[model samples]
Target: MSTQTPPPVATGAGLAPLVELRGIEVVYDAAILGVADISLTVAPGEIVALLGANGAGKSTTLKATSGLLVADRALVSRGSVLFRGEDITGVAPNLLATRGIVHVLEGRHVFGHLTVEENLRTGTFLRRLGRRETERDLDEIYGYFPRLRTKRKTPAGLTSGGEQQMLAIGRALLTRPELVLLDEPSMGLAPIIVEEIFEIIAGLNRTKGTTFLVAEQNIAVSLRHAHRGYVLDGGKVVLTATAADLRERDDLHEIYLGLASV
Candidate 1:
């Protein structure tokens, strides 16, 4: 890890930003660099996307903020991850989870042997709600994913790709997280299903005031769903703009498609 200190927090406009990262550097090995010099913020009720190509450090960004994936093997060598103005630098994964920083990982690691209902129940591990409240949360999750209700007794692995992704997200919702980090919800799914997943993500942020930081490679599709986007390249933020602005940039689309940025 580098010995450099992190940058100071930017001014909060009115209310506190849901999450903030300042000058954070994640080094995978002593030599393998991950994210570098990233300073970004997510406000309450916003859906933001970390857009990037393969190996551009998108997943690493989510993992660092969510406090999952070993930072020990990698070091958050620089910067601070703040949640509600509190420095969450190097906080434990379980602690972050309990504090409502839930991560729906890159792979929808659904419990293979567990029933769909059981899988959902696992999300409530960090929560202190009573049985009644837990049931209420379950109902809310089911409302978000009505399909899960039908397959509540079935093994999660037996579900369709889209359904399993929904289940992963639904289960995370059960935690009542203040911030959610979703990695590649569209992975390996049909285009139509990807659209459906993005709709749900937008709906949750719009209706429930949930804050989201999604990492996705599907730039055009994700831009439609996100309010703002940051493009990552070589472990650094190369561009940032509102979704509309990015859509307007012909050069941006060209770079995204690996064509000449005319």
Candidate 2:
């Protein structure tokens, strides 16, 4: 990793950020660089987006933050990842979940054989909630994704792509995460379904005070819901701005269309 410090963005609005990654670099197979010199922050109850196209390093950044890098033959070679004021870089993925850092990976990896409700139940494995609390949490999840309630008894693999995405996010909610790392939530879904998923994310941030750092390729939809967004290209952050500022900038079109390099 380079010794040069990353440029600063907004942080600590009278409280520590829910997630902070400072000058982080990741490598795979000891040769290939995944992401380099990445720095960003997510305030409590805020929705942040890592916006980029395919091969733009969005997923690599999310994987580093959630400690899933090693499983992919990658490692955080430099910098730090902090959650709720504690350094958690290189922590095991399962241990990170128990600490309220939940990651909903790309492709909505729900268990195909498990029933819808059972998939949700797997999220509660980290927390020692009693039957009553667990049931209450399940009810709340159904309240958020009513479609899942109707399909509770059905196998997850039989659900539509939109429903599978909902199941992935709902299962993460079952962990009661303080900060959620979501990768590509809008991929391969209809525009209407993407809007619905984003609405649920906004509701969760508004009512539940859950912090989100979402990696997405859908620039239009991601900006609509994000409080702030970082535009990444070739594994480096090209722009960081409030969602409103990013929306108003014309130059971002080049970045999104892969016509510009930072």
Candidate 3:
């Protein structure tokens, strides 16, 4: 069974970016800088990777874009965050989610007590879907992750790590997000699972026209799937390049060694 998904709503090259951060600076607790002077763009239907190691401000950047920083008393004290040409610098996270921006935060955050199906249902909190519509959406998510269907009745906390990751992403899809801000989809998963997740992500971008801004440390795999990448280190963007350029420059290795130079 196939439902007609909408074509990519993001316009052509001349159109504004789906998500743009212009010289944005983030601060934590009152004075600690998380990410500074970082600017990047995720064009419509594009998969863009924010590459860096732990504490490199990747998570901080994603949180800033998705309006999640407010929860931790962090703020984008400078610059701006734009969503499809509109200023959403400090919009509330729930509002952003309702506006077709979903953030799948780092660490699989599925509700422990909820069944797999229930977890998926929570993603539709913003949408007023009839029973048929909601079931159809659930089935669609199952198509992308068959393992989820098999484990649909199981408590989310009982699933394997890879299954939990799939649940996290599948839940996000239930929201029908135009843009998904994904953090560390590959973390804690086996290599085969990582590849599987990325393949599904690529398929979603192609068939559903979902744009992704993924924060990832698995450089080799991420660049393989991303259209473009930005390497961040110490709260700053060190390099921005197309995926092929990044591969050719061997920047992936440099990033691993903390030597990525602009």
Candidate 4:
């Protein structure tokens, strides 16, 4: 195990991490290795980025944390996943969501046939809020993504790619999660839209105190919005540092491409 301690970010210093992965190893179909050994931490109210190229196990790590691996026929074969210091390895994803963790998957997933407002209602099922409370929450989400409000009556499938992405995130917010595991949030979006999405992510972290563990290939934008980051290569963590420190490393692109050592 590595003896290094992660540099602290956010006001939750000295408190137990909101999420912790201790040398976790994931396997798919009980044979194929997904991640060899990966560990990291997310302090409450911090935005931490998981940076890597395609197939670098970024999504696998997020699935492990969110307990969504079972959907992919995957499991944490070794080590542990902790939420606020409580062991929760292999817990059901729905159970995890009720425990204040939610995952926005790599692809912008939405109910194509449902109107935008109807789709957001799905998020309130776990909480079982009354009609008034549900409406208030819906308003809050629309406040975050005004575009969603404009398209509230439109089918999610009719929305643009960026609008769909925003809707996915907005719906997740109605769940009132303490920790959000966001995978490839920038994928397939235009650069301007990516920037807009990340800005909202940062704003949520700042105002709502929502802790985030974001898996992304867009290192530049991820680092710009995140407080700290972990860089993965070939299914293992190769670098962990504060965002500023990582941004200053000129060889970061090379490191991502496997052309240089950390």
Top of the candidates by lDDT = 4
Count backbone clashes in candidate 2: 0
Best-first order by TM-score? 4, 3, 2, 1
TM-score of every model versus the real structure: 0.89, 0.92, 0.93, 0.95
TM match of model 3 to true structure: 0.93
Which candidate would rank higher by TM-score, 1 or 2? 2
Candidate 1 TM-score to native: 0.89
Full candidate order by lDDT, most accurate first: 4, 3, 2, 1
Scored by TM-score, the top model is 4
Each prediction's RMSD to truth: 7.8, 6.6, 4.5, 5.2
* Model 1 pairs in collision: none
**lDDT score for candidate 4 against the true structure:** 0.90
Residue 113, model 4, lDDT = 99
For candidate 3, the lDDT comes to 0.87
**Which 10 residues in a row give candidate 1 its minimum summed lDDT?**
1-10
lDDT of 3 at 35: 91
Predicted candidate 1 versus true structure: per-residue lDDT over 92-184, tens digit per residue: 888999888999988898997999999999998777678998898899889888999999999999999999999999988888898999999
Clashes of 4: 0
